[model samples]
Target: MADSDGEFHADDASDDLEDHRVTTSSKHDTRSRSRPEKAKKGTRKSGKAAWEDIQRSWDAVVEDADGSLTAAIEGRAEAEKRARLLRDTTPLQRGIIRHLVLVVDMSFAMLEKDMLPSRYELTIAYASQFVREYFEQNPISQLAVVGMRDGVAIRISDMSGNPAEHLEKLQGWVKQEPQGNPSLQNALEMCRGALFHTPSHGTREVVIIYGALMSSDPGDIHETITSLVHDRIRVSIVGLAAQVAICDELCTKTNGGDTSSYTIAIDEDHFRSLLLEVTTPPVTRTQEQSNASLLMMGFPSRTLAAGDSIHYCSCHNRPTKEGYKCTRCKSRVCRLPAECPGCGLTLILSTHLARSYHHLFPLRNWVDVPWAEAKRSKACYSCLTAFPEVPRTESGKGKTPEKGKGKNNSGSVPTPLKGLSESGRYACEVCRNHFCIDCDLFAHEVLHNCPGCQSDTRGAQRQNGKATSNGDANGAMEIDS
Candidate 1:
C-alpha cells in the first residue's frame, strides 16, 4: 500500500512541472513580439525629430534674407519658367504675320488721377514703350492706333511698321483735354474695317487700353463680338480701373471661352509687361493656315534732295525736299510703311526687313547663376566693369539690397547701373559669360547681337555678311521674294 501512494505523488509532481513549462513559453513569445513594436516606435520618433530640424534651418535662412526684391525676382523667375514650359509644348508656325490695332480710350475718365500724374499721361507713357517693344519683338506685324472720345472713334494713325509715326500722332492728340464718353463699339467697327483689308494669311488682333468702367455702345456689342469671332479676330482688353462684364464677354467669346484673354493691370509695370506679352506669336487656329502665300512688298530706295523743284508728296499732298519713291510704281511718298498711292503695293523700310529676322532667331533668355557657381572673373564680359560684392546681412549671409536703398546723400538713385540685385547678374546661355543689366539690354536692343555671340569667329563672319544695311536717308522698300 505505501509503494502505490508514493507512485501517485510522483505522477502529480510531473503534471505540475509540465503546466509551469507551458506558462513560461507563452510569456517568452509575448516579449519577443513586443520587441519589434518598440524598435519601430523609436525609429519614427527619430525621423520626425530630423525633419523638424531641417524645417527650422530653412525658416532661419528665409527670415535672414531680404524680402522686398526677393518677392519680385522670385515672381518674375517663376513666370519665365512657366512661360518656357508652355512654349516648349506649343509650337509656333513660321511666316505667321499679325495686324494689330491699339484702341486708346480718350474719355473724361482718362483724366482721373488714380494712376499718378493722371491716367491719360501714364497710359501714353506705357503705350509709347509698348509700341517700341512691339516692333522690336514682332518685326513683321503691322500696328495702327485709334482714339475714342466725344462718342466717336477716329483713326489716329494708319497701319504702319514705323512706330515713330504712331507716337507722334498719340502725342499730338493728348495735348487736348479728355472729354465725352468712350464709344467702344465705334472703335471696334473702325478697327475691324482696317484689319479686314489685310490678307487671310495674317492673324488680326485688337488691343484696347480702356480706362472707363462703362462703354457707350451704339449697337449690340454681343453681335459685334460674334461677328469678330466668326472673322477669326482675337481681341484683348487691358482695363485700367475696373473689370467690365461686356469686355469679359467679348474676350471670352472671341477666345473660344478662354477667360485668360482679358486682364486688369495692377500697376504701371504690370500694365507694361502685359502689353508686351501681346507681341508674342499667336497660335494658328485653323489647319488651312499651314499653306503659305506670297505677299506683295516693294522696297523703295531713298531719293536724295537734288533741288527745290516743288515736288508734291502723295501721302501729305505737300511739297517736300526729301521723300521715298515706291520701287514698284516710282510714286513719291512722305514716309515709309505706306501703301503706294499709285500701285497700292505695301512699302516698308530696310530696317523693318532687318528687324523681322529676330522673330526667326530670337535671343535666348540669360541664365541667372549663383555667385558661387559664377567664374572668378573680376569684370563683366560686355561692360568690362568690376563685379560688385554680394551684400551681406547681420547673420553673415548674402542678401540682395532693395532697389531704392542704393541712393547717395543727395537722395537721388544712382544713374545707369541703378542697383544690382542677386538676380541681376545674368550669364549668357551659350557662351557662359556674365553681363550686367544695362549691357544685356543694349546687346538685345541696340546691337541686336549677343556680345558673346559676336565674339565667335563663325558668328562674326555671319554678322559681317548679313550686317544690317543702313536705312535709306528717306526710306527703303521691301519686295516679297
Candidate 2:
C-alpha cells in the first residue's frame, strides 16, 4: 500500500512541471510582440510632437512680420485678428488712399480745342496729376488704364501696384493714333473688366472727360449702362461743352455724378472732399449730391474682403460653374476634346496647368509694399534680384521679364523632374515649399521675400547649405506663395 501511494505523488509532481512550462512559453510570446509595439508607440508620440512644434513655430512667426511670412500661404485662412488691429491702429492720413483711375472718351472729339490745351492734352495732364497725387498719398493702390475710343475698348495696362510704370505705358498709348469709335459703352465695359480684374482691396472709379458724343451704337450704350447700374461702379463724368441730353441721360440713368460744363475747374477742396466722402466706409454714389442717401459704387474700393475667392468669368450673370476655368484672363471653359470653348485657348487638362502656366499664374497671396520701387528694381519674386539683364523689346528698350519665365513656361513644353515623370516636383527647405531646381537657382540673392518663409530667402540659403541654388531666385530659394 505504501509503494502505491509514493507512485501517485510522483505522477502528480510531473503533471505540475508540465503546466509550468506551458505558462512560461505563453508569456515569452506576448513579450516578443509587446516590445515592438512599445517602440512604435514611442516613435509616433515623438513624431506628433515634432509636427505640433512645427505648426506652433509657424504660428508664432506669423504673428509678427519680422520672423517669417507663412501666414500669406495660399489656401490658408486670413489672419483676421492681426489685420483688424492694423486697420484700427495704423495712423493712416485722411488723404492716404488708393485709387483706380480710368480715363474715358478717347475719341477724336476729345482732340478738338473744346477744353484747355485740347481736351486730350488736358485730359492727360489732369489725369496724370490726379494719379500722381493719389499714389503719392497711398502708393500701394494698383492702377490700370483703359482707353475707350471708336467702337472698341482695350486695356492699356493690367492692374499693377506700380501705377507710375503703368502711367508710362499710358503715355505711350496716348502717343499712338486714336482708333475705334467714340463710345461711352466701351469705357463702361472697360470699367466692368477693371472691377473684375482689380484686386479686391483698393478703391475703383471711372472718370469720363468727354464732350458727351453719342456712339452710333446707342443700343450698346444703354445695355452697358444697365450692366454698370447692376455692377455698382461709380461713374464720374466731366463734361466739356458736351450735349445736355447725353450728360443728363447718363447721369440720370446710371445714377452717376456729372460735372456739366466743367473742365477740371471745380473747387479742388470740394472735389477732394467729395472723393473722400465717396471713399468712406459703405462707399455710396448718387445722381444728386446730398449728405444723406449716397448710393454705393466707387472705384479702387474694398468691396470684397481679403482672401475672398474672386471668380473671374467672361460669362456675365452666371455663377462660376466649376471644373475647368482658364487661369489666364479668368475665362470659363468647358471641357471638350480640344480647345477652350470660351476663349479658344488650347486646353491642357491637368491639375498643374494653372500653376505651371505663366499667364494663368495665381494671384499674389501677400501684399508687396513699395510697389513702385519694387517694379523699378525688377525685383525677383524669389531672390528679390532687381535690375537683372534688361529685357530686349521689339523697340529695344529695357524691360523686366513678364510673369512666368521659369521652367514649364507658358510657351515651352514642360520637362520631367530628376527621376520623376512630371514638372514642379522639387522642394525648398528655406522657402518651405516645393519648386523646381531650375527656378530656385535662377532667383538666388536679393530682397525678394520667399512665398514660404515670407522672409528674405538669402537668409534661408545661408542657414542651410544643403539648399541647392539650382534655380532659386533668393539664394536659389523661393517661398511658394
Candidate 3:
C-alpha cells in the first residue's frame, strides 16, 4: 500500500509539471504576436512624419513659384507700357505736298501663305490703311492706285484727293485671285503717264509694292528708268520677298544713288511701316537743277446741290449739283487741283497752298548726347525710367580709378556714374530737352517734331516764314542764351 501511494504522488507531480510548461508556452506565443504589432505601429508613425515633412516642402516650393511668376508678369507689363507711350506721342511733320502713285502686285506669288493669311490679304489690308492714312495726313496730295495682275498693269483708281474713292476701288480689285507674274515695268510706265499731267511745282513719286522677284517687261527697263530720271520722278520700291536687281537699279537711278529708296520687307510689321513712310515727302535731290515754277491756283467754292438749275461739272462734263466752282474760270468741278475742262485754269483748295509751304521750312535734326553727359540725370528725361546703375569692380567701388603717375590718391576720389555704356541719351539742340535713344528715334522718324521745341512757341516760327538766327543751314543750333 505504501508503494502504490508513492507512485500516485509521482504521477500527480508529472501532471503539474506538464501544466506549468503549457502555461509558459502560451505566454511566449502572446508576447511574440504583441512584439510584431508594436513594431508595425512604430513604422506607421515614422511614415506619417515623413509624409508631413514632404507636404510642407511642397507648399514652400509652390509659394516660391507663384512669386517668381508674378514678378515676371509685372516686368513685361512695364516694358509694354513704355513701348506704347513712345509710339503714341511721336509727332508728325508737315512735308511738301506730293503726287503719288501706289502700285500693288496682284500676281500669283502674292497668294503665297508665307505672311499668315496669305500675302495678298495682308497687302490689301495694309494698302487700305495706307490710303486712308495718306489722305488724312496729306489732305491736298493726289493719290492714284495701280494694280498688276496676269502680267498686265491697269489703273484701278484715278488720282484723287478723296480717300473713300481710292479705298473702295482698292478693296474691290484686291479681293480677286492672283493671276500671272507681276509686270513691274508696265506698272511704272502706267504711273509715268498718270504723273506726266501733274504740275512741275509738286514732286512726283511712284511707290511700288512688289511681291515677285522677277519683273516681266515689254520694253527696256533701263530706258524707262532713264526717262524717269530725266523727268525728275523718284521711284521707291518696297519688295515683299527677296531683293530684285531690276527694282534696286530703278530706285538707285531715280533717287540719284540713294539706296534707302528701296527696302525689302523683313516681316509683316516692317512691310506696313515701309508703306506708311511713302506718305512722307521725299527729300529734294540737291544735284538736280531746281526748276521752281510758279503754279496758278484758284480757290473754288462749293455750290449747294439744292434746286440746281442744270449745273454741269467741268471735270466730268456731266450735270451735277454737288460740285465746286472755280474762282477764276467760274466753272463747276468735281474736285480741287483739277485743270478746268471749260477753261485751262488750275482749281485748288487753300489747304493745298499751305501744304506746299512746308518744303521752304524744314525741321532740324537732333544730335546724340554722349553717355558722360547723359549720366547727369538720375532718370530718363522723356520716360522717367530709373537710370541704369554703374557696375562695381573688385578694386574700386563704383568709381573708375584714375591712371598715370601724376594722379592724386590723397583726396576723395569721385565716383563715375554707373552704366555708362548701356545708358545713351539725346538732347535736342533747339529746345535743350534730354531724351532716351528710343524717344530720339521716334521723334526724328515718326513725330518729325521735337517734343521740347513743340512745347515752346518756337515751333510756330517755321510756319511764320521767320528764320531763327540761332540755327545754321545744317540744322545745328547755337548755345542757349
TM per candidate comes to: 0.67, 0.35, 0.59
Question: What count of clashes does model 1 give?
Answer: 4
Q: Candidate 1: which stretches are off by over 4 Å?
A: 1-91, 94-96, 136-140, 161-164, 307-310, 389-425, 444-448, 458-481
| Candidates sorted by TM-score, best first | 1, 3, 2
Question: Among these predicted structures, which one has the highest lDDT?
Answer: 1
- lDDT by residue for model 3 over 248-326, one digit each (tens)? 8899999889999999988897888889877766666543225454655567777777774777776767877687876
Residue 61 in candidate 3, Cα distance off native in Å: 23
> In model 3, where do residues sit more than 4 Å from their true spots?
1-95, 286-291, 301-323, 334-339, 355-481
- List the global CA lDDT of all models: 0.72, 0.44, 0.69
> Looking at model 2, which ten-residue stretch has the lowest summed lDDT?
294-303
- On lDDT, who's better, 1 or 2? 1
Tens-place lDDT digits, model 2, residues 32-141: 87886453442455545434454452442322134433423411322222221122212222211234545556777667664555666666665666555444333334
Query: What's the CA RMSD of model 1 in angstroms?
Result: 13.8
